[model samples]
Target: MRDLAELDDRVTHCAACPRLVEWRERVAVEKRAAFRDETYWGRPVPGFGPPDAAIAIVGLAPAAHGANRTGRMFTGDRSGDVLYQALHDVGLASQPRSLRIGDGLSLRGTRITAPVRCAPPANKPTPGERDTCRPWLARELLLLRSTVRVVLVLGGFGWQAVLPVLGAAAWRVPSPRPKFGHAARATLPATDGGPDLHLLGCYHVSQQNTFTGRLTPAMLREVLEEAKHLAALA
Candidate 1:
């Protein structure tokens, strides 16, 4: 795609994976008890934020009832609750909540996206599905390469998924490849002589992590602050 607008438009219409298409659509129709009266997006979700973002937040995939219901990444979900609040606390978000599309929520110099565009069954996308969706992320990072200086990856799945995309974007991933861990850090040099990219890892803000006290708001904010510093946004 020539631009992020076109990329996002294309993403919403993607049906490349039959399984992902079926699962996302089925969940929309079945409707969770609480959201039965509301309409579900049941479509692929695109990255969120401005085109000139200096920082990117990568998550695993859209949640079945969360982004699937609201048609926006991290919207209407507990995971989003923790994430957006942390961004706001760190002065990167316009507001602390991501309720739905057009909620007036905005990220300053940051974009949030996932490796998988379509929400998968049981929150898991097969290896094939992740590979099939790789081009989208690759193109997105390429489009943002001029401005994106830092990538804050949430969880190991996103960490693993993004490394290859970074390489594809001309960022030289290390030979051994950096392992994933909370607060993990890696600096990837652009083979094309572009600005270097900084990668930061943090535990996902999923309910499992937040509820268990594994990923506190403070911890999340710390990472965001660090990303801002790395991106020169602070």
Candidate 2:
């Protein structure tokens, strides 16, 4: 929901969390020589999708082999394969194949962002890291002007990080609580509108989650359907 200029700036020189910066730098240096000439953004990578999207998809963070390598959120990762397909199936995206930067695909009515803009060491960011990244997200969301009708938090961590921004903070609790599932739906009052912008939850489409049968194409489609159903009124 961030303006393109603000989003672009964040992607260019973000330094909200120290741990992420260190890890991303390490990957940029220690990984294959193929990435040597490819300079790492070494900062918070902004969400990749439409600028005025109505559906906002939130991921945990960038991935070592994924966004860190390709400079685009969810790119070059197995997780993106399933997610992109689900988007296509739900009419939010063009048919998606690969996660490469050259994929030339874009979400039609959806935008994607992360709780932690930078890739964490093992994709697990500490609480402080998540907290530190919230302001920028707040700026983006507040600036979005309620155009976003549904926010899909891709996992438990993602859900927690998002609720506070939506002012569900008083009711939502901390970790080891709710598990991300196919039916997860949190209807939140819209920040601008007095009505709502539903927030659907899901197990991350990571290799671990998908391979473990925790998430599937059919399951993801159902959640997207919920968004579509809710957005139809708006």
Candidate 3:
């Protein structure tokens, strides 16, 4: 189950990072007519799913025209359409469509979060911004510390943000540590409990990926199947 109140609290006044604060506020101002009467949270959006979930999907951050507008992760956007379809195929979601936060959809045994909570300009967050936003992820991880069996990183930055937090091993020149890619998996180096945090890397289902035909529903399902198996084992 999820605590709606807590989720609201986490994003209520999130200003741990300044650049994001300025950017979010600017969007709220420039795009007011669309969301004029609405009170845009324009802050750090928290993870969405069951609080006790063992499976988590981490994305880069909210898109100015996507989650940042809809006030829900993966809602009101084309990117979400692709992702939710895959979740439905993998049996993690009961609904095939994610129209909005109140569309009567639910994530079973899974949760979704972002490294940089607020939406950044051009959808690119600076390293300093990402680091400053780490505390939010850390707080969410601690809350989910009890049962995080698997992590699915949507892109390279998502992987980079999560790996260090999970304490995966590091190597010099040779770099024995694996790189992020479709189907890549690495066990945490003893930081997040002994259970292997099956890390599955996949290309983010962005407009570029989907329109370019780089990612198909079938390809997404294959990786999701691996995630399901790992979640079950964990």
The CA lDDT of each predicted structure is 0.94, 0.73, 0.77
Candidate 3 lDDT by residue in tens digits, 69-147: 6677877678988999999988999998786667799999888888888999899999998888776676676667677
Q: How close is candidate 2 to the true structure, as a TM-score?
A: 0.86
TM-score of each: 0.99, 0.86, 0.87
Q: Is candidate 2 or candidate 3 better by lDDT?
A: 3
How many clashing residue pairs are found in candidate 1?
A: 0
What is the alpha-carbon lDDT for the whole of candidate 3? 0.77
Q: How many residue pairs clash in each candidate at the backbone level? A: 0, 0, 0
For every candidate, C-alpha RMSD to the true structure in Å: 0.6, 3.5, 3.7
Query: What is the C-alpha lDDT profile of model 1 across 122-154, one tens digit per residue?
Result: 999999999999999999999998999999999
Could you give candidate 2's per-residue lDDT for residues 85-203 as a string of tens digits? 88888887776654555567877777778878888987899999998888766666665544667778888788778877766421323344444556776665444444466667878
What global local distance difference test value does model 2 have?
0.73
Backbone clashes in model 2, listed as residue pairs: none
lDDT of candidate 2 at residue 161, scale 0 to 100:
87
